[model samples]
Target: RSGEAAHSGSSGELVRVQSGHGHFVHLVYDTTPAHVISELRPSVWVRADRPGIQFLVRVVFPHVANPRTGKPVTRLLAGSTYTQQGSWQQLRVDDLPKLVQAAVRPMRSQLGSHIDVREPYLDRLVLNLYAGAGTTRIAIDDLDLPSAVAVGNATEMAGRAAQKRGPAESPARRRVELAGNVLQVDGQPFFPRMVEYQGESLNFLKGLGFNVVRLSGAPSDALLEEAKRAEMWLVCPPPVLKDEPADDAQDRPMVFDARYEPVLAWHFGQGLTSRNLEAVRRWVEQVRRADEDAARPLVCDPADDLAQYCRTINFGGILMLHRYLLGTSFEMADFGTWLRTRPRLGLAGMPVWATIETQYSRELCEQISLLSSGRAPEPAASLEQLQLMVQAALAAGVRGLCFASRSPLDAQDPATRARAMMLALINIELHAIRSWIAVGNVTPEIKAANTEGVNPGITGGVLQAGHARLLLPLWTGTGAQYVPDQLAGNLITFVVPGAPEDNTVYEVTVGGLRSLDRKRSVGGMHVVDDEFGPTSLVLLTNGIAVSAMNSGLPGAGQRAAQIERDLTAYRLARVQEIDRQLARVA
Candidate 1:
């Protein structure tokens, strides 16, 4: 209906939308010829014919950076507070910049996303009117939104141009392939024990038994030399974005040059929220295009906990799951069945690495929101939780393990030293059975007795390594890091398939392998009565330890021998250090 407009130059017919069932209607306006939002606010005049009628103003920005994670965000909401019934009233938001910054944090918490929020490019302004029941009409005009000097807006052309990827003219020395959830590099099964690079001595981290280190960016020649000397691999990180999504994907193929031999894989989307998932697809398409030979498999952190949505996601070959809340009963409903739904997630043949990282609980996120307004969230996780976290992920089918927390292993904090030692121990243990993890058939389900020694909290899986099978049983404890002492003495059942009565079972700890009391139960099941605590054991393995190398990879045995030699020394040193840290912390 043509009606008188609000106080403006021309009194012409205004636009209107009909409503039904108290629906939300939005009137969107393109924010072209807009300013940089330095010191401006939006105002609108709204006239309501009914008492319950409400109106709101929202503006969307294409590139509001989440300061902590350094990713862009979109959308802002504001409204009027005047209560004069049925009269024209003006609504304004004075603190637009501050609101933009503070608003993103709660969304991060609500979404359980690990994004950190900055420079905002306000894209569009919208006039929102919530209509009441039985057709309530509201008129809104003079929607003066964030007016200032014109600013340059980013276009999509340059972003798309950037995605063309770098030239790969250099001679490719080796090929990287994914063979049924195992990473095959240079024709060898590569089971990575990874950690974030924190400026620690390269030899120090290597001595701690880490096979791969995720670098901040492309590795320098000197850093490459150090990695080569340490017999370790380096993972390159993706370029950070500052604008629109598509063309933003265009720059940098992650590595400086395609010929960098030490550059093992490219790391993608760490500390990103689910909001930026679309960005991930664009990034992957660009990066995957760059790695034409597919010699460099991407190690992806698939957007923190994506339980909120069941969208199919893409990855850089390997799936590095950030199941940080494993020890705490955070009840990640997605993760509760996440590993079970792996194949359904189109991850049937992809290698998966789970992170112990920091056990980020809801309380911790709340505290970070309420108490601190700074970077660096206080560490809420403990060593005991980290120990159990390792157990749970390993017991599942994680071929690799990463300390995704920034500077976790190298920090001088007392707890951090203990964490480093604990991780070192686990790294050494994983190294001990690297082949089994790298190529063994992962059976994430092992039968456990309902009564007798086994309890409900006890769950584990089997890894069939040629002549022997490894049984890993872990105690998935409560959210508060407290557990009954009896959880340590839980019983686990393993099947000795086609084995004679003389078949022997062995228990593996971080220290070494040992013989345990094996009792046979019904159906050829050997019930092992042992203490399965949070801070002990690699797994239970049958004797003859790994049958003839089932690894068809050429020279797999020789490579394993070399890795084993280094791992044994690291394990010995770490176990000894664990004792020292234990005494020191005590």
Candidate 2:
């Protein structure tokens, strides 16, 4: 019977039924005009409002007219009896083969176990809701049976199929070494200033001073050769396999023993299926045989068992954790330290890499909306904010920095252009100081007496790279009720209270460098305004100081012009070097 269903009733009609033997109601859907069954999952929302009722829900797929005989045949799809009462339930019949087998028990012996059920034909989907002996009621509403291709499942199936196809040729393996927080390729210190871009123009990346390109999956052989010629390294993840269960026995428990603990952990933790584990095994073997020298590590998120498993297999890859800028400085520091101190589940220590997105945080995004009231608010990551995040990670001693986003690097849009410029500037500085930054150990907390009156938000640390020690002072504009103007001109001091009689100290700023006298103070202390603009300041006794000599320093007109000329010459030399490398590859 059709009527308005109670319990938050609406104008829509609902199927009302009384509990009795052979008392049933069904809705038939035709798949003749369009082959709807071939594309979409036929589903209906059912509600058993009355308690203490027993019902059997069966989805029937009647046979279509045989193309040769033009006769209608009987075909059973799926049937299930329900007793428990619940809220609105979604009954979806997507697994047609399994459902068909469960429905037709008598034909099981004749058709055998592996019958192909993908044939597209005119059929009828009949949803039968039957009530058992009891005083009960059922309502059916919101039936969304459509005729279209199942894009989601199709895409997944395609990906699984692709994983079965191995690379045509073996990849050449490269030697990768990690020594004390630094990664070296072929015995040379390799600082990965990477960019995630899909563009083919390596020239842009070269000009931006990036040394690595990170791809989601394996690159083509041609692309690999091109990257080799460009003097850049490629980082890619292993192919993901389908997730199939370890065993098909329904009676067995899902848990595994300690020997299978790693697999089980990976299966549940990383959401890997048995099929995926098999694929990973195959991919690892292929990498081991074909490209022993390549740094083809199986990249994964931070998980103990997963890390242990990879290490056990001698997979040399880094654990990349994203979404860094969302937390407070202390929280970030704690996370970084935790990552560094985690037990080495692998044979060798794995590098900890953190990702930074060049966009506003979710909270900030929502706040923008609330603050704007109705109008659209401008969303962005200020240059100062980006610098704060990168420095924090560096201070935490991350081996690699992974810049992530799908935003087009070559786009003409303003936001994209701004983000690209910010990345380039940051990378330029990193590329310049990578030698010092790569080897330096991060001193999480620096105890200096002179920094008492500095901005409370300002934090300082020292990076000890060899005999030279560089000071890193950072200020994240967090926990302040109001933005202080003085923050833009905050002063950071590095105090060495002992008599370093012969050591020379230089205050390095973005604009240029200036020398400091050792005898000026009791021992020696160098002070400089924490230039909170587009540049960073480092107090160092050694290494080349990076500066914007051409733009902002005073009394450096002639010096700035000379530096500009030198930069022009350097750019030209880089272009010529690229040409030379490309020619050699050709």
- Compare the candidates by lDDT and give the number of the best one: 1
* Most accurate candidate by TM-score: 1
Instruction: Please give the range of 10 consecutive residues that has the lowest summed lDDT in model 2.
Output: 259-268
Model 2 lDDT per residue over 493-543, tens place = 445433234445555443356664334464354444444332344555533
The estimated TM-scores of all candidates read 0.53, 0.50
Deviation of model 2 at 394, angstroms: 1.1
Global CA lDDT computed for model 1? 0.55
RMSD in order of candidates: 27.3, 28.0
Stretches > 4 Å off in candidate 2: 1-175, 239-286, 293-298, 303-315, 324-349, 361-378, 448-455, 476-491, 496-501, 516-535, 542-586
| Each candidate's clash count | 14, 8
lDDT for every model? 0.55, 0.48
- For residues 1-586, write the lDDT of model 1, one tens digit per residue: 2356554555522544543221234566666534436477767776665433333334333333322222234554554433455777776666666666556665665433543332344556665553322244556667676565554644432232222222333333455666667777756788888888878867777755677888867677788888877767888765443333445556534433443556778776565667766766666566665565554777666564443212333344666676545335554323424554553453455667776655355566666767767443445454455556555666566777777656546566544554555565566556666767777775646555544645556555567766456666565444434332345555545554443366566665433445666656555546464555554343334443522222121122223233334445545776687788789879
Could you tell me the C-alpha RMSD of candidate 1 in Å?
27.3
* Model 1 vs. true fold: TM: 0.53
Clashes of 2: 8
